[model samples]
Structures are given as structure tokens and as C-alpha cells.
Target: MQQTPSVLTDQLAVEIARLGIVGESSDIGTLHRVTELACQAVPGCAGATSIRWAIPSGDAGERPEPLASAASHPDLAEVADRQLARRRGPVFDVVEHRRAVSSDDILVETRWPEAVNDMLSRGVRCFSTTPHVRAPVLVTLTLYGVGARALARSQHAIASLLVAQGSAAMSNSLQYDSVHRTAVQLQEAVEARAIVDQAKGILMHALGCDADDAFAEMRRISQTRHVKLTALAQRIVGDQGLPEITERPDRTTD
Candidate 1:
């Protein structure tokens, strides 16, 4: 079947929007949506799998990990597992080359001997892959088919566009996660500082000492009791009420 580029683009946009909304609730769910979208968007795609490759750090090599996957058939998952074990299949090539790769008949493909043999045994015939490079992590979207000529030959253009849309969604998710983590850390710091300050004020009034002396007393107690200064301060402020002064002949309220 033939579909217009605009139609595919529109579908991609809608799918990305869906993933974005789902990401707000669950990141894993968003990735599952991505694999499902790939199966729907790619022509002749019977199954889909997403592989996440960690960018190599220094001299150590980073291995690719399977993040999420969805298959129209059980055999398709077998194909993915076989390729993963071989680590030299179309998906791996896509990651290495940073482009799309396919085998009309995976059983006859010689590029990946081990993987092809496994695919042949599992009755998997066709494979198509597009890479999404998002720095630090490279995501590979793979499609599988049982027919000899599954995906339309030379359809990398449309596949790339689809991959681009998914990549954008993934990028947005990564940014959102980073911002959320930073906000949590900042909030924790603010709360800790506030509690510490409140405890210091309480200690200063109770001990009739300056801020530095109050802090020192808390620190000593914290060490002696093997508790954090903030925790010790909270206990002191909670257990022993702040000193209240009343005007008297011998002592005036200070």
C-alpha cells in the first residue's frame, strides 16, 4: 500500500504527542507506545523493538540494551532475541552506521551469519532498522516481517522521518526527567536549610548564646549522640521549648 509523506508525518506527530502525554505518567509506558507506533507507522512492519545503546565512555565499550519491545507475533520476538545475542544484525549495523539497513530475506543475509541463521530457524524472513541518535544513548527501531519481501525496498526516507519524530519525543522526555530531578534536589536542600535555621534559633534562645555558640552546641550533641545536626536540632527544639523570659527584679527580659 502507498501512503503520502504528509499522511505519515501527521501520524508521526500524533503518536509523538501521545507518547509525550504518557511520559508524564510513566516513562516505560511512553517507550512501549513508541514501539507500538513504529509497528503502525512502518509499512509491512509486523513487529517492533527498541534497543538503547549507551555511548562508549573512554576506553570501555558500552553494550546495547533492550529498553522496550512489541511484536505482532511471537516469532518476531525470537528474531530480536537472536539478533541481540549475535550483536551483529541489521539493528546493530544501523547503530554503527547511523542509518537504516534491511534485509529483504533475512535467512539469506550474509552480513550477519549467526543472526541470520537464528532468524532462518525461527522462520523470520525480513528485517528493517532505523537509528535514533540522542547523544549518550542511541535508540534503534527495528521491524520484522515473515514474508520474503516484507518492507518495500528503499523506503529509508519515510523510516528516517518516523525515527526523527520518535527521537524528538525521547529528547523531550529526557529533558523533563532532568528538570524534575533538579527541582526535587533543590526543594530538599531548601527544606533542610529551613529546619536547621529554625533549630538554631530555638537553641540560641534556650541556651542564652549567640548563633555560633548555639550551632557548636548542637554539633557536639549530634556527634555524641551519633545523629545528624539537623536531627539533633529538631529534637532539641521539639523536646525543650524555647526559653521564655519574664520581667523580674533580679532579671530583666533580654
Candidate 2:
């Protein structure tokens, strides 16, 4: 029984709503859900997997590997790993181009010969990969089929929409992580400032020096002892005598 495209779209929308809620809890959980949805939504889909990599910044460092992955079957992970090892396949193509790519017949796909052989060995006759673009990252959602010509060309739109939803959820997750990191960093900064101020007050009282002088003394001690300003301040707040240093050692060795 063939399902109409509209039905597939509606199903994808419902799944997306569920994913949105799950994504709020954990990005990994959302990814796993997407894999399950991919298998359920796409016609002839025997298995599905999702992979994501952070976009490289300056120097275009070693192409970042997929940070998260989910597969319908355990064996599919092995298949994905083999392709990842080779850095080739429909998934790679989608990541590289930020577009959707598919193989209607893996045995005859010339672009990724190694992946082709691997998928064939694993009974994956066809597969499709769609790019989910999230700034600083690109995710590839893939659906695997067990028979040649399993995916109809008409299904590409549906596959892409599903991937787009997954990408959106992933982007939200990334932003959430970034926000959390920023909050942590800000809290640390605030704590460090508070400690440094307290230590400065102590120095001002002990030496009858101005705030600037107290801060300068602490800076000098920090530089000479090669200790972090926060640690130095902590020691001062603890009423420990400032350690005297005769000379600074060179520490440029990698």
C-alpha cells in the first residue's frame, strides 16, 4: 500500500513536534528520535541514521568527525563507521555540498565506490542523505533501503523536510549548549572578580595602599610566581603570606 505524500508530510510534522519537545531535553535524544522517524516516514526505508559535524573555523582543521549518530539497527552503525573511516558516501556528499544526495542503486553508484561495496555487503541497496544546515555545523540524515530502486525520486522532498526539522532541533540544541557555556563562563568571571576585589581590600588594609597599588602588587606576585590571579587572591583571602619569587622561569616549551 502506497502512502500519499500529504500523509507523509503530516506524519513528519507530528514527529517534528515531538522532536521539538525532546530536543529541549537532550540533543542526543532528539537525534535518536529522528532516526526512528526517518525509518517510519520514508517509504522502503529499512534503516536510518543521522550524523552531525561541527563546521570548521580558521585553518579548516581536520574535518571534524560526526559528533552524534543514531541508527535503526546496530549493524547500521558499523556501516556508517566504515563510510566515515573512508570519508566518502552519500552522507559525505550532503555534508560537503550542504544539499541532498541519494543513491538509488548502491551497487552502481560510482561516486562512492567504497561505500557502495559496504552498503551492498550489508544488504543496503539504496540510500538517501539530506543536509540539515545549522550555523557552525552541518548534519546529514540518511535513510537506507534493502532493495534497488527502493526510494522513488518523488520522495526526495519528504526526506529533505524531515532532515530540515532534525537540523532545526539540532541547531536549537547547539545554541542551548552555547548559552550554558556562556553562563558558566560569566559566573566564573564574576566569582574571580569578587575574590580579586576581596584580596585587594585585604592588601589595602594591610599595606595602607590605594586600590591600584594593591592590584598592582597582586599582579606582580601572580606574574612572578606563575600562579593564576584567582589562586593568588584565594591565598591572600586565606591569610597566607604572599610567596616571594626571585626570578621567572621560561615555559615556552610545547
Candidate 3:
């Protein structure tokens, strides 16, 4: 028995929701999965490709740069490559308009003759491009069909939903990476502070000086030796001795 469109949509939704779990996969992984699912979700879709484009900084006139791409089949990837290399096609048009672009038959498509020829040579007769925007990045999902007018307008909703879910997953993954880096930096800073305090205490006992005097001397030695304060502190704590410092000739008198 053939499944209804509603059933296929529900199944796709469930699959897409699984991608929302942060740290479950990287952005490339998500894009690959999305392309695979696009073929399954859209009726008559022979293959699918997902390309990620980075928005140009401070230059709206500059074209968006393609960062990565994932395709369900080699032919689909080749079609995308041709479009990107030529800098004109449904993908670029979708990005420019921030809307979906579709061609029911490439043999008669006149807007991008070169891209149309590429697609026809690859046995792709119909295609659609859908845009999904996440800040700093724009992702496009393209579905290919082997027969003319094979892709129906009804299938566009499924394609849009897949890219939307893929975008959310990517956003969560980026946020997780950012938070992990910040946590690592904070831990390193705490460790550095503890070691520096230990080094200062060692200085105070050996020099018979107050905390301020000990810190000042350590700072002077650190600056004169061109060593990082944290590195000098770690060395002092490890050896339990002050680093030798050459006194600068008193230039203040001159």
C-alpha cells in the first residue's frame, strides 16, 4: 500500500526533531542527513543537495561564499558545483531573493542556460531550491528530479521543513561549541590564578616582604625577562624558588 502525503510528512517531522539535540552531530553531519531525508520526504525527488553559504561581512554587494555542501548523490553534487562555479542558477537566485526557485523542466529553462545544460546532461530534468537563513549563514536545499515536471509544488512544504529543522540543529551545535570553549578558558584562568598566588606566597617568605612588594617584584622580573606572568608563576611554583633577575643599571640617576 502506498503511504499518503500526510503520513510521509509526519514521519519526516519525527526524523527532523531528532536533529534538534545539541552536540548530537556537527553542522556538516546535519546537512548530510537533511539532504538524505529530503529525497525521502519529497515525492519524485531523485536526489538532494544542501549547500551552506557564509554571508559576507560589511558588504551587502558581495556574494555569499559557499562554505560547504552535502549531496545525496554524486550527480546532485555535480549540478550544485556547476551552478556555484558559474555563479548563476536556482541556488544563487534563491539566495538573492531569499525565496524558493523551481523549474519544472530544464530543457526549456532560459534564465540560466549553462546551468540548465549542466543539469540536463546529468539527467536532471526538474529541480527546486529552497533557502533557509540562520545569522551569518544561509543554507539552500535543492531537490533534483529525473523526469520533466517530476517535482510537484505540493512537495515544497516538505523541503522547507527539512531545511528549517537542519538550521535549528546547526544553531544548537554552534552554541554548544561556544559554551564549551568559554568553560575551558574559565577553568584555565582559575588554574593560572591559583598558581600565581602560590608563587607570590613563596616570594613573600623568601624576601620577607608584604604581598604587594612580592607581586611588584614578580611583575618587574616578568617584564624584564619578557616572560608571560603565568608562565613565570608556574615555573616558580614548580621549582619553589625565585627566578634569577639581573638588576638593570640605575638609569634614574642619569
* Maximum-lDDT candidate: 3
Q: 1-254, model 1: which lDDT tens digit per residue?
A: 11212225675766656653416534345445566666666667666666555667565555555555444446666777777776667777777678778889866677888777766776668877888776655667776666777777655565565555556566677787899999999998888778888887876776677787666666666777688876765666577532222211122221
TM-score for all models, in order of appearance? 0.77, 0.73, 0.88
Which candidate would rank higher by lDDT, 1 or 2? Answer: 2
- Model 2 segments beyond 4 Å from truth? 1-12, 18-28, 59-64, 105-113, 220-227, 238-254
* Model 2 agreement with the true structure over 1-254: per-residue lDDT tens digits: 22222336665678666665424646567677777777777777778888867777766545656887777777788888888887777777777767788878877778888878877877888888887776765778888888888877786776777667777777777787789999999999999999999998988787776788778778888988899999999998998875652233223421
In candidate 2, clashing pairs total 0
Q: Candidate 3: which stretches are off by over 4 Å?
A: 1-11, 245-254
State the displacement of the C-alpha of residue 24, model 2, in Å, after optimal TM-score superposition: 4.0
The alpha-carbon deviation from the true structure for residue 135 of candidate 3, after best TM-score superposition, in angstroms, is 0.8
- Overall lDDT per candidate, in order of appearance: 0.64, 0.75, 0.81
The residue-level lDDT of candidate 2 at 193 comes to 100
Q: Which candidate is the best by TM-score?
A: 3
- Which ranking of candidates, highest TM-score first? 3, 1, 2
Select the stronger candidate by lDDT from 2 and 3.
Answer: 3
TM-score of predicted structure 2: 0.73
